[model samples]
Target: MYKLICIDLDGTLLDTRQRVSTKNREAIRKALDQGIEVAIVSGRPNCFTIRIMNQISGRMGHITFNGAYYRIANKTRQFPIPKEAVMKVAKLAQKYHVRTYFKNKNLSLCTKSDPGILDYDQFKSQTPLKDQMDMLYNVDVVDVLSNQDINILKIFAWDENLENVRKMREELKEIEGINLYLYDENFEMSSEDTSKGKAIQNVCADLGIQLDEVVCIGDNYNDLSMFEVAGLSVAMENAPRKIKEMVDKVTLTNDESGVAYAIENFVLKENE
Candidate 1:
């Protein structure tokens, strides 16, 4: 039986509205009742992840920052990007006017000046977060980065110019100690050892559960790594056709409660 369910939040558990569906929550609670563990794994920061967890009513750990950080109970293990690497990407983003956002320990941050429209959900203007400051810290981004105590979890630059992205890839290719990847138009940077697969492996090892005892569901390029390590992988119908080809099964779209569909038909039914 599967002991762990590692699920991606955006485009997997949460619909385009960026809210967890009731059906999805029910499935998750069912799994929890069945003695399985469910973890919210996302490319978002802990602040947003905690908000999402609060919206649901089940016990779950979090693998946020695209697997660069793992949190269970109140304790956490994080592989924060080095200060130098964080600044490098931040400076590059500023130079290219890429409209970037930074995830630090307590609050997320963005340029107080006009950084232009960002594509990430949390950076959007109408996010459901109650406290605007808690959702993001608008400040002099460069000055904020210079502060030595800042524990950065992730750096994201929205993809507006393909040419700029290409240029960045070529420029940062040799940069040591950082891992960068594209999810949609966004350029996401984190620590070299951070990834969903690696994080899940680490969590599995810690929980004394083998990789084969895990089931993962996601719908993006970042989710590809988790698919590699999961015993069974479910791709959302909204996922690209290329991603669907990579997983064991494809469920309904997020709007259609794909997570719930995957769990009810695959996880719950099989156990029964």
Candidate 2:
């Protein structure tokens, strides 16, 4: 019997329209009623994840920043990344003339003037950016600096030049303790050994649960680490062929409520 379920948000839980279906909500509620603990693990910040949870009155812990921070209940715990390493990555982003977004222990900062085309208001209605800024000690939107003094959690750069991102990944490989991942057109940088899998392990340990008691579901390369550690891994129907091949099961497509379908057909029905 699975005691914990760790789900990825964007492409797994939320449909292609970016909303949770009623059927999925009922499925999750049924699971919770059966005493199963459900959690969301994603590359998104807690501020965004919380808003999605509000729609269903769903309560669960979250692993955010690709597992850099663990948000459970209302308390947030962070795994600090070395300042020296953050500075080095900042310098590289500067060298390549790419935009960067970063989060430290007390603040969220970005170099992007517009934050791309993301609809911050619609996307974060529950835990708005203003709320996050208020909780933060400081927030800054400025030019990329090579010598910023910050203990970074994660740094992301968006560029059309995949080769540049690839080159940056290779250049940072010598940094010794940092991890780099390229997702779609963005490059994500984190501490040397931090990953979604490590974060899940930490959470499981905190709750006295074994890794085999957890189910991980996702649709992207960033989710691979979690998939590796989970006892039952699921991939969204829309996931890349390579990612799908790695999982234990493939459910309905995200457009067809794949996540909820998996829960209802697998987790919930098993309990019944």
Candidate 3:
């Protein structure tokens, strides 16, 4: 029987509008009522991750910075990338004028581009206003990263040119001991060993659960790691063909409350 559920926030649980649908909210509650432990794992920083987790109730866990950090409620842990790897990306970002941001368990740092404007319009589009305010308060100056003394977990770069983003990714791939993930809007770099998969493994060990007793659901390439580890991997209908192909089942799209459908059907109903 599946005892744990790992869900990705941006694409799997949050709809295109970037808000959790009521259907999904109710379904998640049902799973918790059924004694299923729900965990939110994402490439997002802890600030955002914690906000999302707050919205859910009961038997929860979280993995942030793409698995560089793990949190099970009040407890938290960090899995840091090598200092050399982080420094290499920082220097490269500075040299190339790439918009870069660094994340640690306590603070998040970002390069200063427009002193007058820090929040990019596109990146801030769907973010909730309060969360944006929280970020503005917590984001520190980029100079802190130059020292490399801080426990850097992940670095992300953004570009308007999609092709350039992919190109940079190809280049970053040559960097030893680092992992790079390219999304539609940005590139995330981290330790080669840190990923949602590794985080899930760590969480399972903590909870005394086995890999086959877990279910995972996500909607992007980043979510592929947890997909690799889950016993019942679920891909949203909106997910790409490749993601669907890798999972055991395909549910409705996020806007269609795919998470809700998966839990109520495959989880709650099946277990019943």
**Candidate that scores best on lDDT:** 1
Tell how far residue 25 is off in model 1, in angstroms.
1.6
Kindly list the per-residue Cα lDDT of model 3 for residues 1-272, writing each as its tens digit: 88989999987899888898888888888888877888888877655665666676635677878998887744566788787777777666655556677767654566545343333333344444533422232233345555447777887778665665666666687788878776777878888889999989888888788999999999988889899999999999999999899899999999899999999888887787
**What local lDDT does model 1 show for residue 102?**
77
Indicate whether candidate 2 or candidate 3 has the larger lDDT.
3
Model 2 C-alpha lDDT per residue in residues 1-272, reported as the tens digit of each score: 88888889988889878888888777777777788888789877666777777776556677878888886545556675677677676677666655566764335565435334433444444674533521221223333334454567777677656777767777777775667776667777777657899988887887788999888888988899999999889999999999999999898887888888888876767666
Task: For each candidate, give its TM-score against the true structure.
Answer: 0.82, 0.84, 0.83
Q: What is the C-alpha lDDT of each candidate?
A: 0.78, 0.73, 0.76
C-alpha lDDT of residue 190 in model 2 = 76
In what order do the candidates fall by lDDT, top score first?
A: 1, 3, 2
* C-alpha-based local distance difference test score of model 1: 0.78
Off by over 4 Å in 3: 73-75, 114-148, 160-171, 183-185
User: lDDT value for candidate 3?
Assistant: 0.76
C-alpha displacement of 82 in model 1, angstroms? 1.9
Better of 2 and 3 by TM-score: 2
